[model samples]
Target: MAAFRIGEAAQLLGVSADTVRRWVDGGRLPAARDEHGHRVITGTDLAAFARSLAESPSLAGSSARNRLRGIVTAIVKDRVMAQVDIQAGPYRVVSLMSREAVDEMDLRVGSLAVAVIKSTAVVVEKP
Candidate 1:
């Protein structure tokens, strides 16, 4: 079985380290301590949590009708910012956001995610 540290889980879930800690502390996401007494989460559990987060309506909202679901093709992250590219059918949506946000959302190539657009604005809401 493969297990990831809390930081890794946070990266995979696209959430902050504190957020992941809160989830674990609150019991929203299940975790177990490793031999080093550090919190670790399994890949399966992380995937399931990601799915729930992706499906939650509050994150995407009901008014946003222009939602594109697709696979992430590329991601470029710097010290403070990150660029993510997603391919949704014939359309490609690119977004630039905080490096923390990108890390928290675990946005990476070959991962499934969604791009929400409203009017001229584009929001990258990935799972």
Candidate 2:
């Protein structure tokens, strides 16, 4: 039942604000005008749109469903490996991948990207 502004939607989608505007303008995403005459996206609409995007084969792999969209905070590259860090709201997700993959994805600091996480097991520790 929550509503989000264009900027907030962009941050959640790991895209630029202009991209969200374009989506709204192009009718790809649904939005409504607020009292301030600003575009507002409902959480339901945004989630559906995100699901569509995530289902795309080219954008995110089909196996990974837990997608956290955010901006790249840091990237450390070595000869064959690279460590990428993303800040997704209050969560920070890090992943290590091949240098080639990193370069192919054009992952750099400040770049908008999504961290697709597919984990099989999660361990819990008592306090």
Best by lDDT: 2
Evaluate residue 98 in candidate 2 and report its C-alpha lDDT on the 0 to 100 scale: 100
Clash pairs for candidate 2:
none
On a 0 to 100 scale, what is the lDDT of residue 123 in model 2? Answer: 77
Model 2 lDDT per residue over 9-78, tens place: 9988878899999999999999999999999999999999998886766654376678787899999999
lDDT tens readout by residue for model 1, 1-127: 8898988887666567899999999999999989999999988998898877767566554766666788999999889999999987657889888999988987779999989776866566854
* TM-score of decoy 2: 0.59
> lDDT for each of the candidates?
0.84, 0.90
- In candidate 1, which residue pairs get closer than 3 Å at backbone N, Cα or C atoms, i.e. clash? 14-104, 14-105, 14-106, 15-104
For each candidate, give its TM-score against the true structure: 0.48, 0.59
Model 1 / residue 20 / CA error / Å: 0.2
Runs in model 1 deviating more than 4 A are 58-127
Error of 2 at 104 (Å): 14
Cα displacement (angstroms), candidate 2, residue 88, comes to: 8.0
TM-score of 1: 0.48
